[model samples]
Target: MDIHTLDLNFLTDEAIASFVVESSDGPVLVETGPHSTLKNLERGLSDLGYGLEDIKHVLLTHIHFDHAGAAWALAQKGAKVYVHPFGYKHLLAPSKLYNSAKRIYGDQMERLWGLMEGIAEENLISVEDGTEIIVGDATFIGWHTPGHASHHIAWQLGDLVFAGDVAGCKIKQGPVVPPCPPPDINIEDWHASIDRILGLKPSRILLTHFGEVSEVETHFNELKEILQDWAAWMKVPFEQGRDPRDVTPEFQAYANGQLKAKGLSEKEVARYDAANPAWMSVAGLMRYWKKKLGA
Candidate 1:
């Protein structure tokens, strides 16, 4: 299976990615990025001598805008969208999902995510955990790996796992950081998900945040470490009951400082921010800590 990564060219380069995997049946799309970069996705497919209509199967790692926002568009083009069973209703209707995102993104909603429409029920294939989906010679398994989002799934294609946010976000040589977005940030579940990914013994992992991640074991170890570190860091502010608006900037600076400590330049650091905004993490982790504390 030949895998190709398409740079969505999201806010900055190397921020978001969509992957095209070759199978005996045809081209299978892993992540669709956000519809805001749909043209870029089309161009990437065209460059590879295929078109959007040629994609018969689209496997989404999750329903996040960055990972699966453009899925409805592809489904409109007649692609069978493979997603977690928990995410089926939202993708089919999408009104509630779109409105929720509208609340988070507000005025920048269209600019960041574009218009997200609903996919036909027929085009939406909700897969059960550990379900094997055979598409020609390629057998893709959907692993329900939550923690990032309750509806998340890590699509396993042989030894390569298309890990969405569960694998966290890493750009270039930057440090791997967990993207704790609202409504679904489970530290315990995330740790378990990490263990599950490692259980697969993937030779390599593909991150939707950017591209391929080698050094699977080491990367995951680092990810687990950072996940704990960030959660601990958030615990302080959460206990203090500090307003998130006050903590977001501080956390952002702290995160950027970590990136700079790694010798990443301003642009690289900014790319990390673009990929995983600090404010969202602040809110997400705060909510997680609050719930854990039974607050």
Candidate 2:
């Protein structure tokens, strides 16, 4: 039951994935970094005295490319990939996902994410809440905690919960930020998911964006506060008929100022920016607000 943080030198310094529980029954590799980082992942496993074959289970918190893009590679190595039921079909057939991403990323696709292949159905395992999976002697309880994404899952191992993005984004040496990607950013559901994780009384919350955070109580509170503030701020501009594209810069400026006030140095703030493009959140929140208004 060892937890290894694999720092993915992607577009940012704090980008990381947690590989948890290595033993005789074989290690459970959690959250494979994006497809472009396969070499780094292989080297990381080798350095840790474990090869791809040593991994029997690849548990994904979600099907987002940054989080589960490498699941196909791991499945190729015989690892049984487990994910939320909603994301099962996407992994088995990623053509739609890839094409959608391509539309958003355009020419930057390859440079930003590299190639994402489809996972075989034979290696796919769809899980739901309360489903306890036993790898070796350790039991991991899955919780269908959405908000960050509809396909999100949070795994409870012992007293620590591997919170993919339910707890928000906590970049190393930066203000605790939220990754609110578009097409799905429900503030109410996000808060509910936060409460769900807190109720577990986990001693520590492990974030896929970076490292382990033991100040669960304080961390979650701060995350909730900032998330609400961001949402509220976005509402005014949205209701006033401001253009979504025009508001992105304002959002980034606000976020940058907030990060500075939180004691992040210029270099640290750059790290945060690299980890999370602030403008993306602005677009996401705006979209969420528009959807709510329409409903």
Candidate 3:
């Protein structure tokens, strides 16, 4: 299977990407990105000699709007969207999902993610953990990898894994920072998912936040380290009963500092922020601690 990375150009270049896999039947899309970048997705496909109509199979690693927001558009065009069972209902009835995000993004919803519409039940296909879905001659096995989100899946295709946000966001050469959005952020589960991914021994991992990472072992190593580091760091503030708003900026500075230490430019740091916001992680990890500690 030939895979092409389409840059959604969200907020900044290389911040978000959608993968197109060439198959015997047609081009299978891995992620449609948000509807805000649908035009970019179209142009990228067009350059690859494909079109919106040419896409018949869309494999979503998760149902996060940034990853699968434009999926409804493809489903409307007769494409089947494959997603985790937990995220199935949301796609079939996206109002809840849209409203939840609207609460967070407010007036910037349209600019950040465009519009979201419900997918017909017929077009929504929920794949259980370890379920294999074949598109043309290419085969994709969905692994239920939660931690970042309860509905997350890591799509294993051949020797590479479309790790979505489960593997964290690593842009260019920046350090891997896990995206711990609210509603679902369990550090223990995320660590287990990382171990499970390691067992697969994939040669390459495609991150939705950016592009292809060839050094699989090293990439995951950093991801694990930072994942724990971030979680532990958040514990300090949370245990003190510090307001999340107060902790967010501190965590942001800590994350930004790490990026700078790695020699990333100011622009590079901003791109990382675009792909995964620091404030979200603060909220996510804090929520995780609250649930576990029963605070």
Candidate 4:
């Protein structure tokens, strides 16, 4: 019933995080950052007097590189990975996903993601919404909370929820920002997912991008408002047929301005973008608007 946060130190300090749930059965890992940070994850586990081999269950919020890149590697060590059913195929044979990411990252692929391999099908446990997984004395329930990605799931245990990107990303004592990555961003679905999380009435939420959020209501309300505002702002650019690249700077400025007003230092603002790039939001929001227009 104890949770530990692992700062992956991905690209910047406190950018990406993984959670470890210590149970009587074994250690359960939630969100494996990227494969590039696997060594740091190992070090984190070691710090807790455990090792990678000690992990028995790996629960992923989704298969996005930042969240599940190290999942296959952990599975290789005999851990059973639990993920949304929609992502099972990709993990079973990740070549297509790798190629797709390579197309975007190109030269930075290896440095950003490390080695991504296909996980054995037998090692994967496809979970549905409302699925309950019991590990030792703890109970974890999976809620299919799509919006950030169709495969996204927020796991709940007691009054705590492991809300990956569905609850948005907020650095400690900083403004919360929605993680709108492209190719599958759905604003409507995201809104519903946010509502679903709220219905859970969780007292605390743990985010994969950073750490725990104790002010659950305020955090989620602000996240929903900001998410809608960003999407609404991008709608205009998309309607005018403005290139995403051209509008990215404007979006970045607006987001940075908000962070600055929140008393975040320049370095802290940089870490926010490093955690969830503003450009990806531009591209993602544009895609969402375009899809709505039937373009």
In order, the Cα lDDT scores of the candidates are: 0.92, 0.85, 0.91, 0.92
Off by over 4 Å in 2: none
Question: In the order shown, what is each candidate's alpha-carbon RMSD?
Answer: 0.9, 1.3, 1.0, 1.0
- 1 versus 2: better TM-score goes to: 1
In candidate 3, position 26 carries an lDDT of 88
lDDT of 4: 0.92
How do the residues 142-193 of candidate 1 rate in per-residue lDDT, one tens digit apiece? 9999999998899888888998889999888778999999988999999999
| Model 3 TM-score on a 0 to 1 scale | 0.98
lDDT (0-100) at residue 286 of candidate 4? 91
| Ten-residue region with minimum lDDT total, candidate 1 | 267-276
Pairs with steric clashes in candidate 3 = none
lDDT tens string, model 2, 258-290? 899889888777777767777778778888899
Off by over 4 Å in 4: none
Off by over 4 Å in 1: none
